[model samples]
Target chain A: MKNVKKVLAIALASVMAFATVACGNEGTPAVGTESGKTAAAGTWRIGGIGPTTGGAAVYGQAVQNGAQIAVDEINAAGGINGVMIEYTFEDDENIAEKGVNAYNSLKDWGMQMLLGTVTTTPCIAVSAEAAADNMFLLTPSGSSTDILEGKTNAFQVCFTDPNQGQGSAQYIGENNMASKVAVIYDSSNAYSQGIYEKFAQEAKNYSFEIVSAEAFTADSNTDFSVQLQKAKDAGAELLFLPIYCEQSALILTQANAMGYKPTIFSCDGMDGILTLDNFDVALAEGVILLTPFVADATDDATVSFVTKYQAAYGEIPNQFAADAYDGVYIIKAAIEAANATPDMSVSDLCDALKEAMVNITVDGLTGTGMTWEATGEVSKDPKAMVIKDGVYVGY
Target chain B: MKLRNKFKFDKRARQSLITYAMVIIAFVVVQILLATGSMTSLMKGLLVPLCVYAILAVSLNLTVGILGELSLGHAGFMCIGAFTGAFFSKCVQDVITIGWLRISIAIILGSAMAGLFGFLIGMPVLRLKGDYLAIVTLGFGEIIKTVVNVVYIGRDENGFHFSIKSNMDLNMTENGKTIVKGAQGITGTPKDATFTIGIILLLVTLFIVLNLINSRDGRAIMAIRDNRIAAESVGINITKYKLMAFSISAALAGSAGVLYAHNLNTLTASTNNFGYNMSINILVFVVLGGIGNIRGSIIGAVILTLLPELLRSFNLDNLRMLIYAIILIVVMLFNSAPSFIQFREKVTAVVKSKLPKKGGVN
Candidate 1:
C-alpha cells in the first residue's frame, strides 16, 4: 500500500510537470525566419479572394480559374520582369466575416497584393481590412457604386452600374417613347438595390417618370401577379426588373402569363439570358441590359482568354466567370508591375502597387481601356447587351 | 499494523487541493501564450471549441455516467447562452467605456442567463427520464431556431427605427431598434476573446466538476447511475440531483457559448439548433475520451479539432473526409483494453533509442 501511494504521488507529479511544460511551450513566439520574399526569392506571390463555396461558389470558381489562366499565360511569356508570378487563393465563402479571416490568414502567409472579393459584402469587408493592413486590393465584379464612394486603397476594374444606369437612361430618353416605368427589385440584395437606386435617380435626369417602385423579398417571393397587375393598370410601358437571373426569369414568365408585356430594362446580371422549361423566349425578347463581357464577343485578348478557358473548362464561360477571370489578371498586372519579390514586406509591395494602379490603363479582355480615377474607380466603358431571339448579343 | 493503516492508499480518494493548484498553474501558462498573441490561428480557432466541448462532455458525463439519463439538445442551451451573452455584451459595449470589463461581465451574465434557461427547460424534461427527454430538448432547439428566423428583424436606422419591408423606403432611427438581427445573424461583435481566457474558463469548469465528483453528492449521483431504484429507495433525491446536473451542464454550455460568440465575433441562430448530429458529436468526444474523465475529454477535443486541419495540406479535399473516417475507426477499435500499455511502451522505447544510455560519463 505504501509503495502504491508513493507511485501514485510520483505519477501525479510527473503529470503536473508535463502539463506545465506543454502549456509553457504554447506561449512562446513562432520563430521569425526570413520573410516570404527572401525565403522564396525572385517570385511574385499575388493573392486571390473569392467564395470558393456557398451561394456564390460558381462566381468564386470562375475568378479562381481566370487568375490561374492569366498566371499560366504570364509565366509562358517568359514571366514578368524575369520573375515568375504565383497565386494563392482564399475561399471567403461569400461571407464578410470569413473574408476578414481569410485576409488575415493570407497576410500571415506573406501575400503581397490581393484580388478583391466576388460578393459585395466580402468585397467591402476585405477592401476595408486591406486598407487597415495597408495592402492593395482590386476587384473585377463587385460594382456597387457605393464601394467607389470613399475607398482609397482598393480599386475597382469594373465600371459602376450607375454608369450603366446613366447609359440605360440615355437610351430610354433617346427612344422618346415611354414616360412611366415601374421598377421591381430585391432590397436585401446589395447588387439589385444598388443598381435600382442608381436607375431610379438617373431616370429623373431623363424625365422618365417612375410610376411605382416596390421591393420584394428574394427567396420567399412567389406571387408577383399582384405587383404586375398594379403596374399594368398604371399603364407602365417600360418595366425595369433589376433582379437575379433565376428570379428575373420567373418574374418575366409570371408577367407574360398575366398578359402584362412591357419593354424590360435590367442591370448587368440580367444579360445571363437564362431559360427554364416554363420560360418562353418571346417573353424575354428585346430585354436590354448592360454587361462587361459576352462569351462570343470577340477581342484579341478576350478571344484568347475565352479560347484558353474553353480549352481547360470545355464549356462557354458566363459573364460573371469572365469578369472573375479579368479580376485575377488585374491583380497579376499590379503584382508584375510592382515587381514584388517574396522578401519584401506586404506593405512595401502594396506601396509599389498603389503607384502601379493609379491612373493605370490597360487594354483588357473587355476590349476597352480600363483606367482608375482618383478614387480608384475604373473607367471601363460598359457595353449594353440586348436579348435577340433568346440570345444575348453585344450592341 | 497502525503504521500500515496510516500509509494505506485510498482507492476512492477525494480531489486534493494540490490538483486545483496544478490546474491553476497550467491555466496561467496558457493565458500567457494567448494574451501575447503567439498562438497560431489554427490554435486560436481550436481553443474555444476545445474548451466548449470539454465543458459539455464532462457535464454530460454527469447525465450519462452519473444520473444514467441520456439527454440530447445540449447545443440548444449553448445557443441560448450565446444570444443572451451577445445581447448583454452589445448593450455593455454601447453603455460602458472599458473593453476588458465588458467582456468579463458579459461572460458571467451570459452563463447565468443560460443557467436560467436550462432550469426552465430541464425541469419538466428531466421528469420524463429517457428518450422522451431527448425528444423534448431536440424540439426546444428547433423551436428556438425557427423563432429567430420568423421574428421581424429590427435595425437601427439613422434616427427613425422601424422594420422596412422594402429598400425604397427605410426610415432611420436610434431608439427602440431591433436588438437581435435574427436570421441574417448578429454582426459587429467585439473580438475580445483569447486562448488564455478560454483555457482559464475550461480549467475553472474542470475544477468545479472535479470538486463536485469528489463530494458525497457525487457518490450518490454515481449510485443512481449504477442502480436508480436502489438509490431512490435509500432516500436519494433523484429528481433534485438530476436537475442540478442538468443545470450545471447548461451553465457550462452557456459559458462556452459566451466564449465562442466573443471569440468569433459573429452569431447565427442556426448555430444553436440542438441537432442530433451535434449531440452525437459531443457524446462521441466524451465517450472517446473515457466518460467522466476530464483529461480524456480534453484529449478527445484536441484530437478531433486537429485531425481535420492535418488533413488540409494533402490538397485532397475529397480524400480528407475518408482519412478522418479511417482515423476515427482506428481510434475506436483501440479504445478498449491494453492499447495504452502498448502505446506507452512504444513511446518509451523510441525515446530511449533517441537518447544515449544516460551516463556515458561525458
Candidate 2:
C-alpha cells in the first residue's frame, strides 16, 4: 500500500509536467490581435497555415515547401526591396477549430499575407478568422465555391467547386454517357458533397437517372456491398464515387469483390489512383476522374514544373501539389507587385493582387491559365482523365 | 452529533466554491471580450460546444468514476437529444416570431427530448454490470451514428453540393432538391448560441448536478456505487436512482448538443452526431481532470480544448500527437505514487528542519 501510494505520487507529479509540455507554447499569446509588432531586428515575416501532421500532412508539407522555395527564389532575386522574408508555418491539422486557432496565431504574429492549405473546412475557418482580423489570405488548393462565395478578403489559387462539377457533367453529357448513375460520397466532407452534388445536378440536366445516391461516413465501414446492392438494384450502369482517394480505393476493391463492377467516375481524389499498390488497375478499369492537371497532359510551364517537382520530390506530382506550388508563386508575384508600388497598403496590395488574378491568365504548371470569378475561385475547368493500365492519361 | 459537527466542512463544498470562482472568472473575461468586440462571433461559436463537452464529461464521470459503470454510448443519448431538440427548434422557428419565446421553447423542448430518450435507454442498460455495459453502450453509439447516416426523412438541398475532392456541384434541378442537404451537410441552422446563453445554461446544469449530488438520491446512488449489495440491503431503489441520474445527465448533454447545432449553423450527420472518438476524448478529459470532481472535469475540458492551440505556439508546427504522447509519458512517470509522496515528505522535512522548535516539542 505504501509503495502504491509512492507510485501514485510520482505519477501525479509527472502528469503535471506532461500537461505543461503538452500545452507547451500556448503559455502567453492567448489573446491575439492584428496590429503589427516591431521586430527585434526587422526580419520580414510570412504566415503559413496547413496540416503539418495529419492524414493530409503529406500534401500540406509539400505546399509549405513550395512556398519556401518561392520565397527563397524571390530573396535570391535581390530580396523584395532588400528585406529578407521569414516564414512562420501554422499547423491547422485540417480541423476547423484548430484552423481558427492557427489563423489567430498568425494574426498575432502580425502577418501581412498568408498562403497554403488545400482543404475547404480549414479554409473556411481560417478565412473567417482572417477576415475578422483584416489580413490578406490566399489558399492553394481549397476548391469549395462556398468559401469565397461572398467573402472579398480571401482569394483561392485553385479552381472553384462549381467549375469542377460543371466540367464533369459536360464531359459525360457530351460523350453521350451511361444513363443510370450511382454515387458513393463521404457524408462528412464538403469536398465530396461538392462533387457529388454537381454530378447529380448535371446528370439530371442531361436526363440521366440517379439509381443510387448512398452516403457513407469517413472510413466507417470497409465494404461497399450494401451501397453497391442499392446501385445494382437501381440498375446503375455508371458508378460515380467522388470520395477521398484512400476510401475511393477501398470502395473500388470492395466493389470488385462484390462482383458488381460499374464504370467508376471520380474527381480529383483519383489523381493518385495510379500510385495505389494495394489495389490493382483492374479494379479502377474504365474509371474517369476530374482533376486540375495530369503530369503528362500539359507542356509549356507545366512540363518544367512537373520536371522540377519530380526532380525535387522524386515522384510524379499530383494536381494538389502542383496547384499548391502555383499558389506560392502567385503570392510571391503579389508581394513583388506590392513592393513595386512604394506606397502600397496591405489592402491596396490585396486589390492589386485581385486585379492581377482577374486580368492575367498564365498557362500554369497545374493546368491552364487561371480564369477567376469575382468570388475568388480560379476557373480551371476540371479535366477528365482515365486510368489506362496504371497511368493517368487524359481522355 | 457533536463529533460530526466538529469536522463537517465538506471537501465537496470547498471544491464547489473553487469551481464557481473559476466559472465566474471565465465569464468575466468572456464578457469583457464580447463588450470590446474582440472575441465577437467566436464566443458564440465555441461556447455551446465547450459547455456541451463539459456537461458530457461531468455526467459521464458519474457513471464511469462514481457509479463505477463504464458506459460509452453517452453520445448516443446526445445524438438522440440533438435530433429531438432540432425537431423542436425547427417547429418553434417555423411558427413563433418572438425571439425569447423561441429560445425558451427550444431549450425546454431540447432538455425534455433528451430526458425522454435517456430514461428509455437507461432503464434496460442500467441492469448490466461492468465491461458488458461499456461494450453495449459503445455499440449503441455506433448504431445511433449508422441510423443518422442511413435514414433520411427529407432532402433539403439549398441548390449546392460541397465536396472535398472536386468543387461545389450546383444542382439547379428541382426534384433532387434536399432539405438536410444529404451528404453535403445541413446548413442555415439558426444561430442562437450566445456566450451569455451558454454560461447561463452551464450555471443551470452545474446547479442541478450539485444539488442532485448533495440530495438523498445522489447519496443513495453513491451508496450503491460503494457497495451495491449493502445499498440494496438498506432498501435503496437502485434502479430508480440510476435511471434518474442517467436521464438528467442525458438532458444536460442534449441541451449542449442543441446549442452546438445552432451555434455552428450547420449540421453534418457524418461528423456532428457520429464517432466514438468524441465520446472517448470527453471521457479522457474527465479522467485526466479527476473523475467525480466537477471542478476537475471543467478544468479538464478547458485544458484539453486549449492544449493543441497552446502547443502550436511552440514552433513544433505539426508534432501535436508527438507532444501529446510525450506529455502522457511524463505525467505517467511523475505520477508514480511513491516518488511523489517521498518528494512531499522530503520537502516537509527540509522545511521542518529549517524552523526552530515550537514549545520544545521537537
Kindly give the number of clashing pairs for every candidate: 9, 42
For each candidate in the order shown, give its overall lDDT on alpha carbons.
0.66, 0.66
Q: Write one digit per residue (lDDT tens) for candidate 1, span B86-121.
A: 777775576776766776787788788878887888
**Residue B182 local lDDT, model 1:** 35
Total colliding residue pairs, candidate 1: 9
lDDT of 2 at B241: 82
lDDT string for model 1 (A238-261, tens) is 888777677778788898888788
> Looking at candidate 2, what is the lDDT of residue B155?
25
Please state the interface RMSD for every predicted structure, separated by commas.
7.8, 6.7
Write model 2 residue lDDT over B219-283, tens digit each, in one string.
89888888999999999999998888878887887777676656543454444244577677777
- In terms of lDDT, the poorest run of 10 residues in model 1 chain A is A23-32
Q: Please write out the lDDT profile of model 2 over residues A276-327, one tens digit for every residue.
A: 5576767777788887778776566667666777777777777677776677
Listed in order, each prediction's TM-score against the native is 0.72, 0.82
